[model samples]
Target: MSLEPKKSILNLEAYKPNFGASNLKKIIRLSANENALGYSPRIDKELKIGGFNRYPPQHSEELIKTISKIKNLDQNKIILGNGSDDLITVIAQTFLKPGDEAIYTEYGFLQFPQSITVAGGIKKIAKDINFHASVDNILKLITDKTRLIFLANANNPTGTFISKSEVYRLINNIPENVLLVYDAAYAEYIRNDKYTDGSELVEKYNNVIMLRTFSKLHGLAGLRLGWGYGNSKLINYLMAVRGPFSVNSMAIEAGIIAMKDIDFQNHCFDFNLKSMKHMEIELEQLDIKFINSSTNFILINLLDKDKFSAKNAVLFFKNNGVLVREMNVYNLPSHIRVSLGTEEENKYFLKLLKKFIRKNDS
Candidate 1:
């Protein structure tokens, strides 16, 4: 007889990540939303010093201290993860039980639902308005069985986020029994005055967990390093379930250096602001509709969905040696998502975008 897994496990589809081919140097990759500027140069010094033979520090203490200092969070309440996805899994496993429900927005990160299902919890999706997470809609979906709520601030694919007031409303209304998972992977890229990663909320409420990653602005994606801040009790439970040394020494070292490299961080922040504004102007000139993004990526819609669809745009870009994310997986068939690359890369992508539009003019 065949070995059988749980029904939920059997029903789950494998996650298809956008890891570019080995010939990545020849391709302009805007599919994964990774930082194009790369990690802080200070990491090279640490890598040369060497510490590969020994096991990583227990709970990554030094790394935690560095993160705590930067975030102004308590060291005891912080936990490092292999990546933000790792912490998401930890949250799901620690808080959810069989037959419990977890809520996420319709266009939120795909990991939220996958993590919930792996923990044998029901996935409940709340509708979004204009590709933005609707606070009212999410609240309406909540029930006594709802064990967790995953909200991706400056959410992926759509690159749209709710205001601080909206986030406050959601938190104030949510029951104390339901844990809030605020995924802030792209938080560093946002410069909006009205935005918060919900870190302050984590300090105020035992039910909140704020997740951040070194993968985006820090450009340490290859290291797969991330950290979460929450109440001491919640963090202790998450750490209990996490494997000792899930975070490697190299990642920890890289994260520490990256966190301290304020100059590089500021450079990337400035570049993104300038490049995004330039792209926005170009898009407006070409009559291409796109989200007013606060994150490092933009979601562009092709109004002629029937003829010049998102799939066609993806193919056209690929043929031109540029790669953009096709949004069909996110149920955005009319839209394509592209990450802001360096200035030259942005110009090249914009040039090809114009060429594609001209070709499709009918």
Candidate 2:
């Protein structure tokens, strides 16, 4: 018998991530936007001390309580994921079905629509600006068929962000029926008092579901723990759809530790904050155009249009052991994204970048 595949799986393209053996360089890894120092002391201790016994708490009830305490949220309103990526998939599965449509910005996180497609929904792409999600364009594109709208804050590969006022306006304009997914994976990096992470906003705006991750700031990328704060009714539905043990023991242990070790997390966040400022100053001095990042990554476009494509610059950086991502797939073939590293690593990266810029100048 022939094993015939479904048309959707046959046609669907897998989301291509930037990390792999090819990006394993000796100098510094500035591509993935992961913390350089790795997980904190408490996380390390607890993972080892707690032991990955039978499994993580079947429902992540304690984890939800911990997050609620940290964010001052209602435990009932939160749902945990293996990683925030899993949360995205579960949301897609819960809300989307065949013939439904999910919308996202053209150059936002490349993976946002992959979940939608995996859920058997047609993904609609809206226009963008500076690679950030454009709410107006998204509003224009929404229809009765639209089931979900994913808005990635401080979007990947571009690192540009939308202001609070803008996001609020967009939230207000969205119709009550369509689910609005505010992906705030990098929201922990925000230093501005005016900015809202959407966790708190979701309580007020029942249509919104907001994601938060321990991967970026808490140095727990390896642990792969995250949660979504959403309306209680929606969260209850997700609880039914998600895997009972999607979060492993080690990850929950790590998340528990990471949240408690606030001082260490703040140190990492502050370091990235300062590093981002200095980097912007250096890029400006070098006369290179770049986007202002709201997170621990910098997106720069090499202006030597005649000589270097983003891929070529990526090649140049790769040979020099500085791993960065080329934004060709994002429809911006001329830009590259570099992540924040420790002070020493940033110095090394800057040296390599200077060499590349000068060589390309000729």
Candidate 3:
């Protein structure tokens, strides 16, 4: 036998991360949609004072309890991961096999297709109507070989959300033999009453599994703590495949404390609420098209300037010490994604953007 990795591994393009700690101080970094408030102070205390020598729980026992209380689901249904990305991979590992198929919206998170490939499976791209993923379109993509349907709420790059009624209809029509994975990593950012994080459906449908993370609202992105909740039957299967101690010891200690820090979570939520409103007001005056978002980030469709796409504008921002996400890889070269930031950072970015747009006209 040849000394080589799996053929699938050779074909896969690894997920690219944009910012690192060193690059952080050099630019504004609105690319990742990371919480601008930074880590919870409690996370800081836990890191310096929390013990790192011990082996953390392989599955989240207590952390799931809080999530159970928050989501109103039984604790037995949850499985933990290093991050929601890991949870996504775990789903592929458990459910998808060689020659099986996974379906996702055309503009879903980049990791969805990558995860399916990592499991030696093929990915089928379904269409999205405008910014929202069309559930009906996804239904049409299902075949006898399709084992999974991966969905991103308030979808990546576009930052658009599917309505709750549409979600309910999709799950009802979906075949019981197929698994549906709800990747709601940005679920915490939504304030709408109509929004259902798929918790109710997960209760009603054994085929559905939902994933969440401590990265966004809790400001624990660096810690990499994330989890999935579904029926105990599904959770057990994931646990069997997931590596032991995949979630770090320090992250568990930090997570327990961070979950209890409700005050900090609310503060971050309110901050995003204010920043999103203000940024929308500023963008409106420019008369540029944008997607309506109910998440922490927004899709900005910039006015074309001298044959320049939004991808070019992103590099311009980077050159000027600001950073934002370019969506060319997501098949969205005409747009960019920006996370809500601090009052000062938002003002600085707006000033720079206005100057760039103005110069193009002059």
Candidate 4:
């Protein structure tokens, strides 16, 4: 007889990165929302790479200290992980039990449902309002069995975010028993004065945990480093469940340098703002509709779906050596999310987009 896994594992459709366009050459990869300007130059010059023979630091104290210092977060309330995904899983395992329900918005991070399911928990999806997370919709899903709420401020794929006031409304009303998992992986990219990463809520509420990553703006996706901040009691619980030495030595060293490099961060932030503005202008000129983005990527809506569907657009971009993310997984078949690339890459993307429209219009 064949061995069987849990029923919840069977229900999961495995999460795949590089969803499509795998065979394409990909001259300009705007699929993943990575730092277009790349990591800080200081990482190359200042990073001290060593300690291969020994185990990494048990707690990654140095890296945490750097993060705490820069982010103005408490040191005791912080915990590091392989990536934000790892931290999410740790949170799920720490709090969720079998049959407990975890809430996430319609367009929230794909990893939220996966982590909750893997921990033998039920997944409840709150409907989004015009591609934006609805605070009321999320609150309505909560029940006695609800143990967690996974919310991504400046959510991925759609690139839409609710304001700080809405976030406060959600947090203030939710039962204290339900832990709020605030995923802020794209927080660095947002410049809107109305936005808050929900980090402040961690200080005021024992039930709130805020997650950050070195992957996006830090250009350390390959290194896979992320951290979480919460009340000390909650963080202690996560640390207890997390694997020992989950964070590698190189990731710790690099993350510390990345955190300290404010000049590089500023450069990236400015470039992203400029590129995003340029893309928005080009999209408007071409009469293409897109969600006004507060993150590094924009969700291009194929308004005339019958004439130029997202599926056809993806193929066209792939054929032209540009790879963009398809939104089918997020149940957004008519939309494609394009990450902001270098100046030349963005130009190429806009040019091809214009060409595609003309060809289709003809």
Instruction: Give the clash count for each candidate.
Output: 0, 0, 0, 0
For candidate 1, write residues 1-362 as lDDT tens digits.
89989877997898876544544358888888888998788788655557689998968777788888987889988989999999999899998899999999998998998999999999999999988999999999999999999999989878888998999999999999999899989999887788998888887888889999999999988888989989888888998998888898888888888998989899999988998999999999988889898888999999643468988888888877788887787777889889999888999999999888889885
Give the candidates in order of TM-score, highest first: 4, 1, 3, 2
Sorted on lDDT, best first, the list reads 4, 1, 3, 2
Candidate lDDT scores, in order, read 0.88, 0.83, 0.84, 0.90
Task: Tell me model 4's lDDT, rounded to 2 decimals.
Answer: 0.90
**Pairs clashing within candidate 2:** none
Q: What C-alpha lDDT, on a 0 to 100 scale, does residue 120 get in candidate 4?
A: 96
The regions of model 2 sitting more than 4 angstroms off are 22-27, 48-53
Kindly report which residue stretches of model 3 are placed more than 4 angstroms away from their true locations once superposed: 20-25, 46-50, 303-306
lDDT of 2 by residue, 92-143 (tens): 9999889899999898676677788778899899998656778889999989
Q: Please report how far candidate 4 places residue 343 from its true position, in Å.
A: 0.5
State which candidate has the highest TM-score: 4
lDDT of 1: 0.88
Residue 302 shift from truth in candidate 2, angstroms: 0.9
Largest lDDT belongs to which candidate? 4
lDDT value for candidate 3? 0.84
lDDT (Cα, 0-100) at 216 in candidate 3: 88
